[model samples]
Target: MTAGRPEPVDRQLPSDEARELLALTRDLVDREVRPRSAEDEAAARFPREVFRTLGRAGLLSLPYAGEYGGGDQPYEVYLQVLEELANGWLAVGLGVSVHTLSCHALAGFGSEEQKRRWLPGMLGGEQLGAYCLSEPQSGSDAASLRTRADLDGEQYVVSGTKAWITHGGRADFYSTMARTGDEGARGISCLLVPAGSEGLSAAPPERKMGMWSSPTAQMHFDGVRVDRERLVGGEGQGFRIALAALDSGRLGIAACAIGVAQAALDLAVEYAGTRQQFGRPIADFQGLSFLLADMATRIEAGRALYLAAARRRDAGRAFTKEAAMAKLFCTDTAMRVATDAVQVLGGYGYTRDYPAERFMREAKVLQIVEGTNQIQRLVIGRHLTGR
Candidate 1:
């Protein structure tokens, strides 16, 4: 653990390898990620080299098969790794999550030849990826996307815009969804488009209040030609593939939320213990102590909820509902815990000197991304009512 930060909770690992992986993650975070996080975030600088360092360490591809250059770790272990990274820096952690999500369509639906040709390079960490599903007009209503991919002999001419794309301009490749046939979900298809393709361009990154170190931009495909071989899965299968990937991605978001909450709670507790009031530590007061207790409880609960969802996924169980519930609860908990943390630090927390205010800002986005809390509740409700 970094100096003055709370000790990480003792995690139960299934094997010695998992334990070793956690140790390595902690060392890397303390040495590289945590130290530079505040500086990079404040300047809104994307730390591409840090991502490269993580790639070199095989930390970027933990959940996929080892044969294709992934770590071959289970979801449970992979999520815990994400938690540690998020605790260090939300931008890096969420960037990793988005990259993993971008790879899902190709890894899970591509033919063997396609996987052999592309998966190796992607999972090897030499290249970065972005998922292009949301458009300017479509957010939660993903099936209403208007991006077109007209068939042209052995290629697809893609034209449209993808909004709120993480690593939009910097990614080497994009896993993009486009309308291929009639309107609605059935018309969609997935394609892999390289960054240097002619007619493909990215708009300036969005100006955001938090997670500034992660670039989010809009990508435009103006008659970009993609080879037919780049098509992932069959035509009309893109929506299903996208949904499947989201089930897993939701768990990733949940883990990241818990990590943020834990970090906020740690900061609050450390400050409470050291900052004196009326010649006594503020932590000695019953009012502030109760607040800290509630924050800790919420963090613990959020962690358990995400871990349970991850375990279900690893067990090959249907975890869509569980994933949604986890995403909703954990993100909401993070928002609350981070807000409370800001309160715990009083005036100092509101200033940029401490990270409490930053944490609060970062926590708000988690509730909105990867399918908002409202969408998650809709998913869970549908599952319960079979509607």
Candidate 2:
């Protein structure tokens, strides 16, 4: 049985406008998203209309520049919106994060002419985007990818396979990375490939552990021709762009993890307060109450960590290490919190009759995607030791 809605988080907004934005997001979630989350997810249906709704409302383009159809909001404000959306439903929220990641190369490094030509429609919300960096052979060692994009005349013909791509078959565009020169990271370059291009096709969607409605599939480019103008940044800059995009993407995952964790905690607290045991509320006991306290404490810590990293990004500071830390700690916290919530619910939590099980399944992918938690630790360690 669904517990009643939890009270809204009291947020400290940067301005009245930001407060209004969050309110709008919350209203949208309550009216349109939360009610159908479980049903849609169970049916393996992607809510494209919901994304269109977000797009039409300008939620999809919040952190980009306003001049090119973006909202120009600071990362701080944008991330809170993500967190709220995730609180209602993880798939929709993480879908938005992936869409934003797909747009990163063009927004951050595209030529002015490129932005003028493409950025508006991309950020306009009518279009969906996907990022392609991981290959079947290369997961963390992205530098060794064999996808090739060789220049011929005025165009580049691409041929390779990219695996574990989100929105693989459904996206309007794919921001792809391919090898254009010597082997390794320096040879890589980014290209924005349009959908329906000849020789470009997607394999069947992978059977996933969670987020079923959000398709993850392999993309194949069989001599898919792209104009030289479609190159983002330049040849040999793809690896750098991918890393930069992931740094910000990790922060998005961190925010989403907190959202899932907060939702689970809310469920646990509500269940404990109402479920009777020994003729008294279970929450009245110190042991169960202490668990709730720890859950809340960890959630706050995760929130503060992500927000601090977001603030650094907003200030134009290097946040690679901080973002890694947030992603690692927050996702780990989500997994622990979700599992404990299941424990708090006793046997009821294990069943799909409640949302706690779903939260646990969804929280798991947060640690794996963007970058694995192990990779995050590696990133932090490298930054710390300069080794």
Candidate 3:
């Protein structure tokens, strides 16, 4: 859900250079992503080369530090890049977002040495990463995650299962959440686990309704061993780290939702103007025209919401409520806009021959992922109440 209220008047907007990058990102999506997304969707294949292209363009690391092979770009700029990718192809957008989320534990709380060891690979395409926090029983209630990690001399043996893991089998690295001390949120800890670690395995991907191109699997850590140095933060600091990572991650989802909405809108608008009924373009009709207007309005508004939150994050301001609002608003709007886009296309939109049906399916997942819209409401509700 990427929609949020309008930005304050004094807040700085995208700078000249940032605007250029945004244009370039959107251009790349139109040139590369839009043309290829359909095939990727039909084949249910991951476009690993898309990462190579993005890495070569320095787009993958747009939000990270330049010293670590990243662009060190502002969040405002980086989110625009995300918005563009998502607009053309959600799988790539989600892949980028998950990679960024994985990078968070290392960037925010990891020791300098740890960052040096890991950040470069994550920023580049040489290494792919996943964030493991959601469990089968604990999606909205992340505090109930039961993965366990027990110390065994200098090494720790981590054992548990993480559900709904993006890039689960394909990722080279996993930023995992585990229980290391007690019960509830305070007991959790974050660990950086390499894919090749012994006893670490993944179940075959879950049958998902949308985003079929991006793999989702249940990862099992049966006595998976990690070095003491791999600990992301001090003991029992995992939940705090996860929450911080998610605050930013939600903005990514917000941007992705906007992308989904735009994709569906683009299809609907083009189809409305081309496909004829009653001897005229449907775009000529007042009723459908009004729907298109609303769709366009929501897309722009959703973009503004995530951009606003990203700017706040970049400026070191309190933006949790803003991010949650963006996630809540944008994703809901995407679901609605995509659903309506299909209706605008009528029967043709529902067919697999078109992207709208796929977009509709993908939009529903956005509401479920990151944090469900309900969870986002609770976050916003608690913030408003000072809870």
Candidate 4:
């Protein structure tokens, strides 16, 4: 910022103050993200510049080490930033979440050399990343994936298909989970697959009901070869890495859900206050007011749920159940709140003229991705029963 212009935002982390930083992040989102979202969604196009913009702003890799060109902010603050981003552009938020999932493999399990080689471009957002876990035959049961990466004389010759990949061929690299040993979960091994590797190609983007702006596609790995150095952890530890990523990935989706819901509620409240009904503004109606009230309540509850999970994680506590709870609660709340937001807008909500429709579309994918809300409940239920 120059004279007469607001100061450029400070996204750096200092352990002493979080509220102030989050407010700044919110202002940054209002200034940068909210203004361009409509066009981004309308085109169903990925903004390559947005990634570089976030990279320049130092806003993309919160919770990752600054040494790796990340902000190194705590999860609590990182998530609030994501909330504001999603509230502005769901595609951007989902991209960050998927990128984080890709980073999870390196951060949690990568060798020091691996971290050094890969973390810069990723944490800087100079390149996008995708996690290849789900296949056509397996979504929740990722271990049952048919993709195979067998060792050749000097490399692993990989072959199979992965489905519903967020970045797919568009990403610079894929964090792939493939069968490398015997059948079942124990057989899966995680590997790093570069995009455009020989024999690797992504199918046409999915014709989806929502998240149309976020590219989704099926990946084909036809004899793609990778060196042993590309293996993430060990021969049979793919399931562990996959589950570990999901544990944290669930929080990212929860944050995304809360943000979308918040955006929908805000739009609904504003529309209700200004739109005329009967002889006055529709906000005057008790029925509509109550709907707004419930919307606010649910948004607050969902925000609290995700933040609690974030805190528990930062504290080094066992937080699987909490993360799952946040995912389940926030995603469902998003669906309910988005539906209500549409109702508040009447026919306008059902059309592209307003964002409520898009919000609703984006909300559905949050529930389906990361883990289905049903799967989230099963995770929590299992923990509750001490299973």
Candidate 5:
């Protein structure tokens, strides 16, 4: 909710540079992001300029190596910046996350020649990206995706549709996964398809419940020809690469979840303090006060959990289970905190004139994106049980 100014967050940054980065992010959010968030979101307008501004600010490339026009900020620092941006506007924050996710396949697994050719532009933020994995029939079971990329002479001819793709129509590039050989995960391959591929097209954006400012659409590959060099990682390695990227991407979603919840909590607290009831502020009532307390607690806990998972990743430890846990807990927390925020505002919260209702709606998609909460539990369970 953009109803009130965000409360200051006490962040634990690793270095002076990181501290400066956070300050710069806050300044940018206050000046550019917060002011237009309400109006732009209301009109379902995507703020491409905002992303360009963030790109120029070196924010869009944080957590990547600096040699390729990246910021090279660690995951811990990068995630906190995401939290701040999301606190201002979820569409922007999540857009940044999806862009980073799109870059992961090449950044982490591409050949040296591939990196030298494409890394600079993608990291520079002038070009946005989309990750294509989930198909209409295979949202949760991504390995079952039916998109095919068959070899034809020196090029691969792709054919199939990718559903629920973020930045689907507008991205400069797409990191697409398709089946190249036998069925299932072993046959999947990752491809870097440029936006203007001959047979590539995007359907009209989906009318989503929230995050309207970020476009989501189904992308069609009608025999789109991609060069052999565009293959990311080895053939039959796409599923492994995709899973690895999700391990990190889930943390991004977790950070964004905390940001939304933090914004909702801030609005709820501010409203409770200023809006009078029963001849005094409703915040004075024990019932409402306890609810606010619980909301704050969950936000703090979710933030810590995500940060913990991020730290594990930064340390090069296995963090898939932790990432799943963070995604599950933090998104659930956002939903609860946003709902509580509306409850605190009472009748005003339900109205579109206020942002509590919007926050509630936005929180819902977090539970579904990346992987659903049910899928997160499955991941965690599999990790624990050695399945």
Candidate 6:
């Protein structure tokens, strides 16, 4: 069955502006994103222009202050837009999320001069960004990262590798974390390193199971010197900044997960309603009907969970545990829903002539990125036990 654009989620936005923003997001997704997604994925082509288009349209800077060229929308509205984008293409949706995460430190903690100088270009459509946190040796255990940035007179000399960086080679800037002092989490600090720094370079992108249009690679900083002015927050503040960014970033991942699951479910439902089994549409049978029901229910539940977390964040509540819970539940739900969609399509899903297989592959990465679902569980458990 040919996959169609899934129906838009009936989002309960807070204002006319938010409603209009969602409408704009849908229009852009249909006109610019969906048509090129399958082709780009098949060719392993990165859609830099598509991101530039998003930037021009102001989708790039939602959920930040308007004074710094942000859209100034609430997280609830911003996340729904993310869900819609991911419904069109996971790479694009996740890319926006990562870009926003990369901007978090500078936008939230940078000096007024830094904001005045850099935020406009960063938040505007002129530049794309990457978050540099994970390393070859430190994946889930991020606090143990060995990448170092030593103060050398008027600048900091950065040297090390950051692994699994989205937009690694292509980003205009990198919000990098590096050790500046003692050998622990407290030693780490944040820096906004421009992409063309003398010693900064990237390895070839990873050959992944899906989302080939979104590049992931290792970035090398070979004594790359950044001006002292680029340091975000304070020395020894990177770990805290990273964790704060993650709480919101996890919600973005959760929204993207739901979008993928929703797409898979929509494709499955369409196929089931049309495909005949024993001279009758498969959707008429209780077995297939029940499966579709479960998929829809899971998508709805996941959407609600992520939105609840977003609302807490928007309201300035401590949402660390809630964000983790949403990330864990939503990603697990996406994997299940995508698998069920593939099963519903039988042989077609396996071949990827249909997107069910792609959905399944894409769903796997959501559980691992931002933070592993296992890591999410640990975070939730910590909140519960205060341990």
| Count of steric clashes across candidates, in order | 0, 0, 7, 0, 0, 0
In candidate 6, stretches whose alpha carbon ends up further than 4 angstroms from where it belongs are: none
| TM per prediction | 0.98, 0.99, 0.94, 0.94, 0.99, 0.99
CA lDDT of 271 in candidate 3? Answer: 84
Pairs that collide, model 5: none
Q: Each candidate: what lDDT?
A: 0.91, 0.94, 0.87, 0.85, 0.93, 0.94
Error of 3 at 41 (Å): 1.2
Alpha-carbon shift of residue 311 in model 6 (angstroms): 0.7
What is every candidate's alpha-carbon RMSD to the true fold?
A: 1.2, 0.9, 4.0, 3.9, 1.0, 0.9
- Number of colliding residue pairs in model 6: 0
Cand. 6 Cα-lDDT: 0.94
Model 5 RMSD in Å is: 1.0
Q: Looking at model 3, which ten-residue stretch has the lowest summed lDDT?
A: 1-10
* Model 2 Cα lDDT, one tens digit per residue, 73-189: 999999999999998899889999999999999999999999999999999999999999999999988899999999999999999999999999899999999999999899999
Q: On a 0 to 1 TM-score scale, where does candidate 6 land against the true structure?
A: 0.99
Better of 1 and 2 by lDDT: 2
**Candidate 1 TM-score over all chains jointly:** 0.98
Candidate 4, overall lDDT? Answer: 0.85
lDDT of 6 by residue, 129-242 (tens): 999999999999999999999999989999999999999999999999999999999999999999999999999999998889999999999999999999999999999999
Clashes of 2: 0
Off by over 4 Å in 5: 4-7
Deviation in angstroms for 167 in model 6? 0.3
Displacement of residue 105 (Cα, Å) in model 5 is 0.3
Give the poorly placed runs of model 2, Cα more than 4 Å off: 3-5
